[model samples]
Target: MPYPDKFNDSYSETKADAEKLVMRANGREGLLTCCIRPSSIFGPGDKLMVPSLVAAARAGKSKYIIGDGNNYYDFTYVENVAYGHVCAEKTLSSEDGAKIAAGKTYFITNMEPIKFWEFMSLILEGLGYERPSVKIPVSVMMPVAHVVEWTYQKFAKYGMKVPQLTPSRIRLLSCNRTFSCSRAKEQLGYEPLVSLKDGVKRTVESYSHLQAQNHRSISKASIFLGNGNLAKTVLWEDAKQTVTVLLLLAVIYYHLFTCGYTFITAMAKLLSLTALFLFIHGMLPSNLYSPLLSLFICCIYLLSND
Candidate 1:
């Protein structure tokens, strides 16, 4: 096959070049190229598309759902996509290969097509995050996306480009783009080995490593924010006071609630209260404080009922 230079940038040119290669390789004995177009390929360690969305959600950047979020898309697991390519290559090179080569173009994806919002919710749940609450229409985003794309293009001429909410990207988000994988399944016996849930689990495991890196970044940010000894001293003192209050509350709750001996219950309550107080104090000026406070309240309620 003749490799076309810079084919990734131009789909039409790439398809034409690929067709020529397929025609030439027809009835040939050795190697043949098969083009497998996969839909939204994603898995563990993915840094683009879905993984980017996941990261944005975690960082609170993705606050809104585009359109009604009812659009369906065929999402293919990266490993399954790879396997399809392998199968295509193997089938094309086999002795009775004309069966595989005759007008063959495979739409490789997971057999199941899922609604966009449902998939997003699954991803959020897998990562222990809440689903997005806001929704915006495609019509509303069009003008904004146009302006952003125009600004980006204008800046590109000056060799200075900025991130923009692009029109093409918005269109993709709004559209229902589900691909048929039945041809691939029939011809190559291809079946997705990884379910969406399993794939998300793998992705979450990879995200745990990234979270450790993020923790170090947050620690550095705290140091930077508390620039002086006075700031540090004030913060620590506030934290200590909060801890003392929480400890007292915990002791009262445990004695009245838990069946454990008074001493053990008091100690357990004291330690939990101390940790919760420090965490709450540290998270002030951040959005996490309210949720953490609510969680603590719930815990107290449950303990009292016990």
Candidate 2:
């Protein structure tokens, strides 16, 4: 299919314009330029595709498939994409290879096209998250996407974040975007350095931090703390509150305990500080400092015992 004369978003429009400029500059003033179009590039350290998919999964929005879920895509692994670029550069620099590759565009991939939804399922499942099960047709979702886009445009200045659901994105999810790399194989000697399966595995392993297990009620801290209320709030459980408590405790220790004051004087000062901290904490929102309050209570109990 030929390139569309217009694009739905400025991102796609600018990218198309840039590619055209690069193609136009190919043979001018000894410049050897070519476009390496990697299809649906993915893998570890990908800031766009994987993150958005994971975000949707976390947000409970990944339950529905965008279309019939039969859309095939050539999802290129990051390493394979790098290899493709290397091949292109080597071919462009070589005398024989440059004859065929210098001015042409090449579609690079892992050569293992998979059903788009299946690939999405693999990543989600690998990360201990549920795969999309409900299928919604593109026709049904397009209008919803349009509404969402319009709402985002209207409320964007009021701190409404840009939405993921858009007409172009919906089309991208539902379309068959597989590409043949035969031209690249014959001209540039390009081949994927990593298999698609391994790529997906590596990508999943890289995001262990975002695994569903970590987001569950039975987190590591909870398990270690015997699932007590303090277990969920103390130490490393809530990092922000833990750090704040530690800083406060450190100040109390250095300013009061280390001053060579009598035990009664130090205890009196500590109680006064704790009372003031609790008073201020009570004035704030409940969720904002509830963990701090719990930590402070625990500290007071421990000090009483000491």
Candidate 3:
């Protein structure tokens, strides 16, 4: 089945897709549907959120806590979420399936809501790192996010798809989006096996082992501090060069497909294209993007009305 355009947003889309799938399986003799919506999942070998935070702390990038850092979130251990899914699958039957049918969503959190900053601090402390001290207000961050997103979009048309301080990310940092896992507990009889503290201990232990291996590998070689710094600098420079090449390619592609004639005219067209990109980039700030994008869309409506 095709996903609706409105499902582009994560919250809406994920729930919408689950509901659609469940509805399709309804009334089938052997089919049963169970939707387990897990909260912010963290465990060993996680690459996206938890590991990224750990890396950022190690690299001295997690010292700045954005917004009030007091926002609460329901974080679930990966094993717990998996356990809930397994329980649902085992219990879901055609006779009992209707009890867990379409539009019935279960929150699969650990039933513990922790403040964002506290969670970060716990992870850092577990890893033998200092907790963050700097706190930036959401109001001050909104404009900076706007500019960063604007810069990315403007250059992206020129082939620079650089990271932007998007509005959604800002909201994630600032907004309180805690969910209750009562439904999962009641229906699937799901319970989280690992506590947050135990999870952090396990994660830190694994990271320490990996770091020790890295140190051993480095010690085996004749590598010095200067050599490490030089290698890092070279890698950073190479990445910048790659982005520049991609930007040039984007400009060339835009000119080729859009029928812009002569160098001056083509550059002018590119400027207009870049402006549109900048507008989109500006809309990328996690705090401002949602409202700004809606406004941009509204303006399009007003203009079309004429």
Candidate 4:
């Protein structure tokens, strides 16, 4: 339970408590329970870490490092977790090893501790993202992270997903935490199948679609005015496109509300245009018609307004 000297706010208190529950159940008759604490689990099909990191990278928020980049973190590959569990099970079931493995706790990891920021750089660079270089003091980051977490907690009842940069996450990033898997290695015969480099490679390849090079970063104003990358590019990437969209919106607004058209007449005219569109759509060949479908759909939306 000793915390690192540099950081007072140690991460994973909840998980630490859960680990204790297994330890408490350890000596119960006919029961075999042991806790496996895996650090920073990352791999393919990882919905939590991978997606959140990628989202931050895509948002250009991954360009800043909290505090010095020297903190060591134990990162475990997902497959290694599976392997560790299997080894634990075998050790628990085998009469020869049961005494050594049962009623115990083990730290599961790749046994390769890297500087936390360096690990982030590896994942980001592998996924064609910019490695975070700008250093921000933890004192500065903590307040911002606190505000973000508070805001999220306040609005979470309205169905908001918790953001990645919480106070605990900041502490984890800015502090050192390297767990020993020596006991697991000696007792359960658990060895990491995936090296850190190999695991990172697999993770990056799994998320090819989220590569940073494929996207264009934007400013906060652009994001607020527009919605996101997809929305910005589709609407206002080109000046002509922006103008066209605005003009169309204005036209629709004018016809529906500004002009002296009755609701019934507008509805009737909208239906007539819709019928004409369907007629043209039907006449066009499949290959030729497919690409223009979105434009026609937009036109339908425009007509429906008036």
Best by lDDT: 2
Which residue pairs of candidate 1 clash?
A: none
Q: What is the alpha-carbon lDDT of model 1 when measured against the actual structure? A: 0.67
Comparing 3 and 4 on lDDT, the stronger one: 4
> How close is each model in CA RMSD to the real structure?
18.2, 11.6, 13.8, 9.7
Error at 182, model 2, angstroms = 0.7
Each prediction's Cα lDDT score?
Answer: 0.67, 0.82, 0.66, 0.77
Better of 3 and 4 by TM-score: 4
Order of the predicted models by TM-score, top scorer first: 2, 4, 3, 1
Question: What would the per-residue lDDT of candidate 3 be over residues 49-128, giving only the tens digit for each residue?
Answer: 65666566544567888887888988888888888878776656434655664335678887778997888787777666
Q: Model 4: per-residue lDDT, tens digit, 25-109?
A: 8768877877787888999999978777778877667888899888899999999999999999988888778778877778999
lDDT of 2: 0.82
For candidate 4, give the lDDT.
0.77
TM-score per candidate, chains pooled: 0.60, 0.69, 0.63, 0.66
Q: Given candidate 3, what's the lDDT at residue 64?
A: 82
Regions of model 4 farther than 4 Å from truth: 1-14, 27-29, 152-163, 213-306
Predicted structure with the largest TM-score when compared to the true one: 2
Of the two candidates 2 and 3, the one with more favorable TM-score, higher being better, is 2
Report the C-alpha displacement of residue 110, candidate 2, in angstroms: 1.1
Q: Name the Cα RMSD for model 4.
A: 9.7
Clashing pairs in 2: none
